[model samples]
Target: MQLFYTPDITDSPIYYLSEEESKHCIRVLRLELADHVQLIDGRGGLYEAEIVDAHPKKVALKLLTRELEYAKRNHYLHIAVAPTKNIERLEWFLEKATEIGIDEITLINCQRSERKEAKAERLNKIITAAIKQSLKAYHPKLNDITPLQKLIAQPFDGQKFIAHCEPGDKQDLSKTLKPNSRYLILIGPEGDFTPKEIEDALQNGFEPITLGNSRLRTETAALEACFEINFLNR
Candidate 1:
């Protein structure tokens, strides 16, 4: 079933579809009046519907029922990382991570970070598609790019960890996590975070942790941490 997105469906028929979606339903799908379909609002709600009007310029639907779906994962994952120099790869990471499941995201600015800026608009679009594609209720929170020191100073309630490459850090992400807990993992850039950066994080009570054996890229490391925290369900 093709998924249609509408934020408000309040038991209404003849709901207006977006411009692109209108074309797909009426022109591409050739869905007729009374044809059944599904709709999600990019939030927690899902609506089952039937096409009430199928004008090529405007496709409308009537809601039959609505339900909510929740993720099975025991923990919430927030993968924080420095923005990549290769922006496309970073975009891919955002898309895939959302599809796989993540609670929140933060783009950090470490001392060695090649890029300090993250385009909130572009990332928002990527996240929107991921939520729809993955059939998820909540969209992951995308934080603005921030300094590493400042981020550490903020009060984070859950298990806080910093995934720096500097040697001698002990805890493993997989082993350290507790089921159903909220987790935040900080990953650094290509050149890697400086020693002082790691020291600051450690002093701020952020645990030094490792994702796995093989070295991974900045985005890969962030995503790997995401997978690790989410592994309880998988």
Candidate 2:
């Protein structure tokens, strides 16, 4: 089944595809009138639609059915990680995390961060593609770049963890994770979080957790945490 990302879909009986989506459907895919297709609003809404007009610029569709909260997961995961120096690595992480069922992501700036900024537009595009490719109805939110301290100060009801290489008492992330619960995990940069940063996180009720025995890169460690959380929940 070919699933299209339509974030603006509503409860109306008739809906129109965007210019980009229209072009792909009518021109690229060669879909014609009466052709059936599936659409996801990226907010847990799935629609089965039939093409009424195969216009190349604005394909009109008649919604046959709509399902809300389709295939919703039992757990919510939010990963706030320091973006890698290489933009490509961070992009790869976002793509895989979206495919693996992450609920939210934040690019955090740390004291030891090599790259302090990121292209939010490009990264968001990658996430949207991954959601459609994975046939996911829920879209993962990509938060703007945030300061490490600022995020730590925010309110979170779920378990909070900071994964750092600092040599102190830390719990294994896989073992510490509580299944079917909301989670927020922090991943440091390649150079790792500073001693003061680690201390600040601990003081703020964030537990120190280690991914594994072998040290991993910033992106790798973040992905590992993502996969571990999903695996445990599975």
Candidate 3:
């Protein structure tokens, strides 16, 4: 099933594909008039559409059917990690996390963070592609880059955890997670979170957790936490 991302599909029965998406459908995929295509609004709506005009630059489609989908997981999973110095690694984490199932993501700047910024546009594109590849109807939200202190200060309704390499009273992430409950996990940069940063998180009601014994890279730890949470919920 070829799924296209069309987040702005309103109540109108007809819709025009974007130029990039049009080229892919008409030119690359060679979808002809009357051919059926699938669309996802990234807002829990899946639509079955038929190609009305096979214009390479502006392919049009008529909606045939619509279905609303709920998230596979009962709860929300939010992972905030310090951006990796090598952006490709961060991109890889985003792709896998989206495929596995994630509700939200935030890039946090820690004291030891090497890269303080993330390309929102490019990262969002990666997320879109991942959703299409994984056939997910809902799009995970990508939050702007935030500082460690500011992020910890925000109010969260569910369990909050900080996964770090610090040797303290830390619980196993998989065991600590509660099924069907909202979760927010923090993964630090390559150099890891500073002592003061960990203390601050602890004071702000964030529990310290460990992924495992072996020290992992920033992206690896982030992805591991993402998987662990989803796995436990399953």
Residue range 155-210, candidate 1, lDDT tens digits = 88888898877789569866776777888788999988898988888888889998
Model 1, poorest ten-residue lDDT window? Answer: 5-14
TM-score of each: 0.90, 0.97, 0.97
Model 1 TM-score (2 dp): 0.90
lDDT of each: 0.81, 0.92, 0.92
Instruction: Write one digit per residue (lDDT tens) for candidate 3, span 1-234.
Output: 567999989889899999999999977887799999999999888899999999999988999999887455688999999999999999999999999999999999998999978799999999999999998999999999999999999999999999988788899976677789999999999999999999999999999998889999999999999988888888
Number of the top-ranking candidate, with TM-score as the measure:
2
lDDT of 2: 0.92
- Residue pairs whose backbone atoms clash in candidate 1: 74-180
lDDT of 2 by residue, 1-234 (tens): 567899888788899999999999988999999989999999999999999999999999999999999989989999999999999999999999999989999999999989988888899999999988888899999998899999998989999999999788899867777889999999999999999998988889999998889999999999999999988999
- Between 1 and 2, whose lDDT is larger? 2
Higher-lDDT candidate of 1 and 3: 3
Using TM-score as the measure, what is the rank order of every candidate, best first?
2, 3, 1
